[model samples]
Target: MTQAVAADLPIWAALPVALLLLLGAGLALTGTLGLLRLGSFYERVHAPTLGTTLGIGCVLIASMLYFSVLQTRPVLHEVLIAVFMTVTTPVTLMLLARAALYRDRREGNDQVPPPPPPPRGGQEEGPDGTTEEMAAMDRAELAERR
Candidate 1:
């Protein structure tokens, strides 16, 4: 009896649901390919953004559709999660990129732009006749010194 009831459930919706899942899979695949094909870390970062945004969007949409249909009620928890992810992912990516830039600069890596040259006047002298410039060390130079 349960088998008949389950079998009688509308199967037509599967078409749309499957299509959505396939779309999500394709987006994720493309994003992965972009991550591999890109030349630099900065460029590669954008690839995952696509997957984290649109790929997840499609999957969430599919989940909402499937659950709503099966349960005969609107399922919206996935929507909230999707919204939160979309909002937070970019912020996280930005922070990571900034951190990478900071570390690379500190390491004096050639891949990133060098920090601005120190102020002129050979170094500002303090009241004690010591140079103020010597008081604060350049991050890259300090790292090299160590």
Candidate 2:
């Protein structure tokens, strides 16, 4: 389809769209670099999630502004894409992290932290031999447990 010439775009709309596209591209590049440079799985997951979400948001906002101004009507397709992305990205991150944690723990990876102690009633001793309230225990008793 034939597109409108750049000359048709006003200074008001052109400037913000240009800035937003640049900002979005920079954020996406940062996230990509973070994913490559980070050492651990947990750390690696965070960069892309933040980067892509914010980057896409900026780009989408720019698109909305450009099309809305050019057409003289509200353009909203970006809203749906933004909504789906905002909702799903973090959720996918959590699911991946949890799965990795579970796998690492199951395989007895030393780097993973120990599971939290199970719930206890009042002052019952946990399976690990420490009580729910360690503060109430004397130093000698605490040492004895260890």
Candidate 3:
């Protein structure tokens, strides 16, 4: 069982904790604002990383401090979650961006960069003996044709 203390906390200790919590809230708000204000998909993708990384980091520090002070035991679970999120979020974002690019390219949309040219010297000869370069077909159209 834990007992609550009514005594005033020291300025040094209380100040840092309060500052950390305020910083975390500020970072979260900034990240959310970035998400709303940024233009384009690629630009928007970078906004949430600020919250997931820095905002959560500040909050985690505050959690560790509060828990350690209250229970007299180090609370480290937030560290694990922070590490996992940092490692996985970038990978997931990369995959999603790649998938979006692929989909857009398949639709012949001009928003994405053009794919690399096909290999040379594999041209098939037509009935008229003229050789033609093989062009990549739209993925969605190919799927529909199939």
User: Highest lDDT: which candidate?
Assistant: 2
Local accuracy of candidate 3 as per-residue lDDT tens digits, 29-134: 9988999999988788889888878988898888777666656688888889889988998899999999988898999999789986543444443556522322
Q: Could you give candidate 2's per-residue lDDT for residues 1-146 as a string of tens digits? A: 99866657889999999999999989999999999999998888888865679999999999999999988999999999999998988788889999999999999998989765544454565567655346554444556558
**Candidate 2, 90: how far from true, in Å?**
1.5
Residue pairs whose backbone atoms clash in candidate 1:
none
Model 3 vs. true fold: TM: 0.70
Which 10 residues in a row give candidate 3 its minimum summed lDDT?
130-139
**For candidate 1, lDDT tens digit of each residue in 36-81?**
9999998999998778889999989988988888889998999898
Q: Which stretches of candidate 2 lie over 4 Å from their true place?
A: 1-7, 119-146
Candidate 3 RMSD to the correct structure: 10.8
Each candidate: what lDDT?
A: 0.82, 0.84, 0.77
Question: Which candidate leads in TM-score?
Answer: 2
lDDT: which is higher, 1 or 3? Answer: 1
Candidate 1's C-alpha lDDT? 0.82
Q: TM per model?
A: 0.69, 0.75, 0.70
Error of 3 at 113 (Å): 0.9
